[model samples]
Target: MPVRKLLLGVLTLCYPVAIYFGLQHWSPRVMALALVALALLRALTSRQAGWRLLAVAAAVLAAIVAASNHALPLKLYPVLVNAAMLGLFGWSLRHPPSLVERLARLREPDLPPSGVAYTRRVTQAWCVFFVCNGTVAALTAVLASDRIWALYNGGIAYGLIGAMFAGEWLVRQRVMARGRHG
Candidate 1:
């Protein structure tokens, strides 16, 4: 019931739903608008700077969708979305009590500094992964003139998410092994 878990669950469900409706040729503009509205609501309720930035990015994405309706450029939408997500990620990273800090707090009080450092590194790596994947997805959509949902939700989305999950597991395993040894 934690906020992080709630966000993760919402994202997990929303991604597939977005992909499904998008592939069906639903109005991307509407989708973008809805997201923007939600982001705006969040921003209004929370005083956090990160949430405000997210709201702005969401609004920008809505504008991109509206623009794309007039002229279907290959790289336009994807590039815009990727840049927005990257900017949001960067903003979140800059703020305090980031993902790394949250994860570290979950650990035992007596846990070594190395473990905390490892967790921070892993979280940072995950942020980088999001940036790289977003860039690739955006570029592919823009240059290929293919449907963004189809391309991103197909092999690319699965592969990237799977790889990140596996990488996280591997890091956790190594951390545990080191803990056992020490």
Candidate 2:
């Protein structure tokens, strides 16, 4: 639970760097084997449904990379992750009380009507961000150099997410202030 909650995101982001350096020292098949071991270990340690789904996806990707003897499949992990997040957030929109709303409720259980609307909009915005980010990731994986892929996926991507978090927090504060004053 601790690893899944705290460390999983960092580990996931490191995938690009791992593959980039791994190919320098090992064969694609060997790298694929390592990925499978990591996935299996994570699966065994975590009971989260989301992690289980990701484990299956990772195993399939590993199998493809092993058989194909290529890094393309390995590089698609970010795209796959974004797709999964989009699915989760989009599904929540249809089911009501969106993903962001659920997170909001964790801190403010009795969110006002305005807060609910804001969270829904925020979830939709995240869906858009996931789509755009995944598309760029896929393009880089297919067309860009391994170094570029690692740079963007491991570095720029996290920076963009941090920017989004900061931007949203600023916007939320302004929204709350407006609600209080108006």
Candidate 3:
């Protein structure tokens, strides 16, 4: 499977897990420990050693925060993780068009017919997952009478998801236009 497809699948799974963890109000220790485990797994499997190392470092920091049980660190960790995710998505968006051309070059004539279709399906699934999860979070926040933190965190998650959707749309538009005009 292509890296893009794999990433989309992972993100789809992560989105729901994040929402579940948030809704459960999982203790910082539990959340941090889980994320650390995830990071370690990602690091071990990732092709990029540098990013893998960074993930390891993030895991360590999360472990420390969990151990300390500090409110400030707990509050900051979510924001930091969200920022990192946003940055990764943005970087993917900013890649040069030539990269796609290179992918086209690399394609084998005998490649399976399902490859492209499968990628599209995965990408679309991810879009739906983000939209639904984000909407649910936002609505729960708005409807709840108490828990200001829930409302605030939900709002942020919704905004980030919206941003990602908008970015994806822009990329699709650009790609379509290039296909038509090129």
Candidate 4:
């Protein structure tokens, strides 16, 4: 990956933890300003429309945080991320060439029709996952304490995502092996 994207990805992954500790040391306005700066950095580095929109959303959220001086706005970044993922994956389902298929094609460029269908189903699964994850993220952001929010958004959420990826890898291995035999 490009350094900019890698850096942004790392920063994004660290966001919840940053918010958790930042709250103890920084004012909400400062936190909000940091979010706005991150958003601007993302916008500058990425040209994809979805990413640009995400940047705008982040900026809006930052504005809210700045105005309200509240931690909840800071906490909603994960929810926003999930919503964006859901939108991307769900839209690909309605359109042709599902996102997972596009990605799978990077390695299996000549993927068979069954592989195509399988990727579509995987994309659908991701949409479902995004919806459920986003819902939980929203709930944690609003109804839970900061520690709970941080724990879920920062740690537990990534663990669940890792589980999904590992499960998918196992299933994909079976499918690929079966394709060779059958």
Which candidate's lDDT is highest?
Answer: 4
Which parts of model 3 are misplaced by more than 4 Å?
2-27, 71-78, 85-182
Give the RMSD in angstroms, all C-alphas superposed, for model 2: 1.5
Higher-scoring candidate on TM-score, 1 or 3: 1
lDDT of 2 by residue, 115-144 (tens): 999999999999999999999999999999
What C-alpha lDDT values do all the predictions have?
A: 0.59, 0.88, 0.51, 0.92
Clashes of each: 2, 0, 0, 0
lDDT of 4 at 171: 94
Q: Higher lDDT: candidate 2 or 4?
A: 4
Instruction: Give candidate 1 misplaced runs (Cα > 4 Å).
Output: 2-32, 41-47, 67-98, 146-149, 153-155
Q: What's each prediction's TM-score?
A: 0.64, 0.94, 0.43, 0.96
Instruction: Flag clash pairs in model 1.
Output: 74-142, 75-142
For residues 119-177, write the lDDT of model 3, one tens digit per residue: 34434445454445544444443453324434445455656668866876686567657
Report how far off residue 149 is in candidate 4 (Å).
Answer: 0.7
User: Tens digits of per-residue lDDT for model 1 on 37-105?
Assistant: 555665666676865675676566567767775223212333444555556545556774446556567
Kindly indicate the candidate among 2 and 4 with the higher TM-score: 4
**Per-residue accuracy of model 4 over 38-87 as CA lDDT, tens digit each:** 89988999989999999999999999988889888888989999999999
